[model samples]
Structure formats: structure tokens, C-alpha cells
Target: MSPHHEPPLTRLAWIGMAGLALVLVAMSPVAGQVAANVAVPEPDGYRMENYRAPTPASLRGAQVVDTAQAHRLWNDKAAVFVDVMPRDVKPPNLPAGTIWRDKKREDVPGSVWLPNVGYGVLNAEMDSYFRRGLAGITEGRKDAPLVFYCKTDCWMSWNAAKRAMEYGYANITWYPGGSDGWAEAGLPLEVAKPVE
Candidate 1:
């Protein structure tokens, strides 16, 4: 009831404003990403989502690498680079003069283009096929270094990496910086064709 004392409602209002300011300040670090063309790395303990790819729950066993590590693995003769980006079949109905180009299928040189490898809903047949293909690629060696990638923020590589880990592979690297990341680094890429 004193002139120096603020009313309870006014005090609450001030408290709310202070809380709001703190939240904005904390989020200011990423405000630029919303406006810029830069790729934003996922926060230390949060999921980064894209329209198509959802972030995985845990990457405990799978090591997430950037473009550099990817490059290193690319040179390793024993390392297997798996590009799990799904390939879309061209429509056969296009006119003779019309041109339809395939998706940017070029990957970091020596990468295996595994079309249809990133399906969220893999039936038993496809799942078995994936396991077999992975095994064959690594020559049935669980200790072989395997790198899985697709495109930037693609859940395909994440899923593939996790699947490989579950299959008991000791070293599985998830290159979250997929094809886009590779090309952005000005690294060499080779044209790839989908294997039926």
C-alpha cells in the first residue's frame, strides 16, 4: 500500500516480460538461420526435422560425421559409402521430344547408389534385401567401416545407419551432411546410377 510498492498485477506483468525477454535472448543464436541460406546444425540435444526426414531418437552407437570425415572414408578402400537416397522412376508417358532428367544422382566418388534404401515402411522382403545388400557390400565383415548418407538432414541415412548398427556392425558412420554437404565442400563427386 506504499507509493514505492508495485501492485501485484503490475509485478506479475513485469515478471512475464522478463521471462519473455530471456526466451528471446536464448533463441537469438539461431534467429539468423531463419533468414539465411545457411544450413543449421542440430542443437546438442534436440531433433532437427525436415518436411520429409525426421531426426532419429538416438545416435549412440552411430557416429555422426561431417563432410571431412566422409571424405576420409571415401579414400579408405575398405570403407563402404552407401548413398540411400531413393530414386524415382521416370514416367514412360512423356512425349518423345520431352526430356526428363534423373535426380542429382552423383555422390561422393565411389559411393554405392542404393535407390529405395530409405523407405520408412520397409516390408519384410525389402528389409531382408537391405540386410543382404549391406552384408555383401561389406563382404560379411562386421568390423568393416560403413558410411551411410543421402542428402542434407535426410532421415534415410539415419535410418540406414541405425539399421546397420543393429545388424552388429562395429563401425557405422552417419554422414548427416549428405550429398548436398559433399558438393558444398567442393569435393569430387562421380555420377551414380541406381541399381535395380
Candidate 2:
């Protein structure tokens, strides 16, 4: 037998070691939660800031308005209608005084065209542009209600709404029922001519 001797660990030492291990394990979950919560926007798309997760309750009666309501809002020009539709869909069908992105010429009537395309599609640049685009639509007016939509179950509008909230926009609404919803209503479609 070797004559080497070792000091026995005291109870405090065992407790200290156990506490450190517990802390590390506990912290792992928090770190993961933070990473998951900070969901980065898609590539070449708009990134979100100060984002908060949306629950069904918060969106309750929060103007997840239908096609008719959207039309009424459009006629009154009471809200800035944003279309984040991907390229390839037919141009937006805007009612009188309604604004939307012109798929043909990269513009929308009284609305800004921010197509779901290009570099950093969801990066800071796109996010910044969305902020400015929304600003222009509202003309620096916060009270102006903002409505957003895309294709049915499309995530772009949803993302846009979340980002808008992050930007401290109030009275913001998302029409999950998008172009499909509008078409279902048999609303007259206004097609914009292609740009030369």
C-alpha cells in the first residue's frame, strides 16, 4: 500500500460543490430560453427588435379585422395597409383611396412596397426600412392604425406585426386571413398595370 495521504473533504466543501453544479444546470435553461426568445428574422428578411411574443389574448378583438372591415378602413384611409406578399401573386386589389404595394413598379398607392425578397431579407437593414416605410405610411402619426397581411397563414405579415410592436407601435393589427380572405369575400380586384 502506498503511504500517500489525502485530506478528507469537509461537509461545506461538498455543499459548495453541489451548489455550483446546481447553479450551472439551472443556468443552462435560462440561457437556452434567452436564445430561443431572440428569434432572428429570416435570411434577406426583416429582423425584429425588442420583440415580444404574441398570444391569442393580446390579439383579441385587436383588429384582426375581416375583409369587409379592412375595406372600410381602406375607404376611410384610417389605417396604413401593408402588404408583405411574396413576388408572384397578382397585384393587390385596392379599393378607392386604398394603398398597397405595386408589384409591377416597386411602389404601392399611398403605400410602400416592401416585398419579401433580397439580401438580409430579415436583417437589420430590412427591419430599418420597414420602420421607415411604416413611418412614411403613417406620416409620423402614431395614432394612425396600422394593418398588415400577406398570403393565408403566411408568416411574413405575422413577423411584420411583431416587429412593429417592437418598434413601439400601438393599434397594430395582423390579418392572418390574408389575400385568400379578401378573395373569398368576392371583393372587386383592382389590378395595377405593369411598369414600363
Model number with the top TM-score:
1
Q: Residues 7-90, candidate 2, lDDT per residue (tens digit)? A: 355656777999999889768988778755564333333333322222121242246776788778777887776776545544
In Å, residue 109's CA in model 1 sits off its true spot by 0.9
TM-score of each: 0.67, 0.52
Candidate 1 residues lying further than 4 Å off, grouped into runs, are: 1-30, 34-58, 90-104
lDDT of each: 0.75, 0.59
**Residue pairs with backbone atoms closer than 3 Å in model 2 (clashes):** 44-120, 44-121, 44-122, 45-120, 45-121, 45-122, 46-121, 46-122, 47-122, 102-107
| Candidate 1's TM-score | 0.67
What number of clashing residue pairs does each candidate have, in the order they appear? 0, 10
lDDT of 1 by residue, 1-196 (tens): 7746988898899889999998897688577566444444433432223425445434778787878877877866657888888788688898899988887688878777777666655779778878888878888989888888888867777767767776799899888788888999998788897655
Residue 171, model 1: lDDT of 91
